[model samples]
Target: MALTLHGGRPGTDYDAAWWRSVFGLLGECFPGLPGGAATAEALGFPWADQTTPFTLSEQGRTVAHVGVLAHPMRLDGRAAVVAGVHAVGTTEAWRRRGLARRLLGEALDWVDERFALAKLHTDLPEVYAPHGFRVVPTHRFRTPPQPPAQVQKRLLQPLRHAADADLLRSLLRLRTPASNRCATADPGWLELTVAALSGALSSGFWHIESHNAIVALGEEAGGALILDVIAPEPPPLAVVMGAAGAADRPVLWSFSPELSCDRAEAIPTPPEAGVLMVRGDWPLGEPFGISPLWEH
Candidate 1:
């Protein structure tokens, strides 16, 4: 049997049924996850030209999928296009058939035609290494056991409107880069992320006025997870923890090395840590990192 490759912007070639079916497979693979088609829709799928969906089908039924989000970023101070490859999955029945490999190849080809580089975050680096992606080092920070008492007075305002989105975008522009690899957090992406992640994180999207920072936080079986953070400086790790009300819980902060803050422990390229896989010759300098906020 021959497999067919089909793809298009979310709403055009793919409809709600297709989106649900692909996300259904993903939910089954990673149970207890809240995101899927709904998140994609909020991100302006089909309508948003930046995101494109690809699928592999056998006998007219979708079996594998991948998505690409075209993001413009500064690579060593030069404008570069980075394709964020995400939502990659294959139905359990289709595993080991090379469906994913074929789909990835097609996606990369598509990316190559329009973008300067392709990037994705995954724990399974081996799966992407053969495709020309190299592992870029990233750092994870742990919050101190006892947060500063002053943080108790600080508050995190929930994102509620366009103005708030604007603020988040501006904060993203601050901070010096140790390396050139970084995503441009335009207003559209920030709004889409805030809406998409609100359902996953109990706290949803929030910003600290006192510290000029924004964060997406959620709780999982492992305790509290700081999914993303944006700030001028390393806004106090303790304050971020306090703002999220996860002060006593085990908090994992994913950030670039250029951003500094108090940390209980510094993780150096752990296997479990998210590895960046890229295709093509996208030059990266030392001390490079992409924030968790832009992972998907």
Candidate 2:
């Protein structure tokens, strides 16, 4: 039987039923994951005008799926377009059939036509290496124990309006230029980030304001995760953690090491880093950083 290829911009070319099938497959493949139709909608998957979704269907049922996010990034100080490949998956029965590979190949070809770089963070690097992705070193920082004086909770404003989204976009812009490889601070992308973070954390998207800086935070397992920090100078890690009500929980940072606390520890890269590969040449040298918030 021949497999049919379906390609389109979600919410326009495709309908909710299609997305429900895709999300259902993802749920089966990745049990315990917190993503669903609601999460996908929040992440701009349904209304992503700039993104292309490719699906392979057998008898009108989607078996394999991949999403290509048209991400604008700064590479070596030059503005460039990159495809952030994400949500590549196949139904359990479809595994070992090269469906995912075919879907990925199609996505790469699509990206090659319009972008200079294609990147993805995944746990199956070997599966994509043949497709032309190389793993780049990434740094992870662990917060140090906070001093008692810094344990007092600070006010955190929840992201609830378009104004807050605009503020986040500005903060993202302020931080991205400092990194060699980073997603552009487009308003749509920032709103997507806020939605995704809010869905993941019961507390929703949060920001803290200090005299000198503003920071975005996400909560996981009762611990705070630093999503982004916008400040003229790096603020005290303890203070940031305290503001998020994570004084007792270790804060995990995915941003640059320079923004981390002086006493923070540099942890070893995870085994999955081996599969977090990039295909095209990124002007930035090795040891670059990709924030966790921007993974999808």
* Candidate 1 residue-wise lDDT, 70-118, digit = tens: 7766576677667888868889988888888888898888888888778
Model 1: residues with Cα > 4 Å off, grouped in runs: 8-11, 32-50, 141-149, 152-200, 204-206, 215-253, 257-267
Where's the lowest-lDDT run of ten residues in candidate 1?
152-161
**C-alpha-based local distance difference test score of model 2:** 0.60
Give per-candidate clash totals. Answer: 4, 1
Task: Give the TM-score comparing model 1 with the true structure, all chains together.
Answer: 0.70
Q: What is the C-alpha lDDT of each candidate?
A: 0.61, 0.60
Worst 10 residues of 2 by lDDT: 148-157
- Candidate 2 residue 23 Cα shift, in angstroms, is 3.0
Best by lDDT: 1
Using TM-score as the measure, which candidate wins?
Answer: 2
In model 1, the clashing pairs are 10-46, 11-46, 76-180, 133-278
The TM-score, computed over Cα atoms with residue i paired to residue i, of candidate 2 is: 0.73
Stretches of candidate 2 off by over 4 Å are 8-11, 31-37, 40-50, 141-199, 203-205, 211-214, 217-225, 230-252, 257-267, 272-275
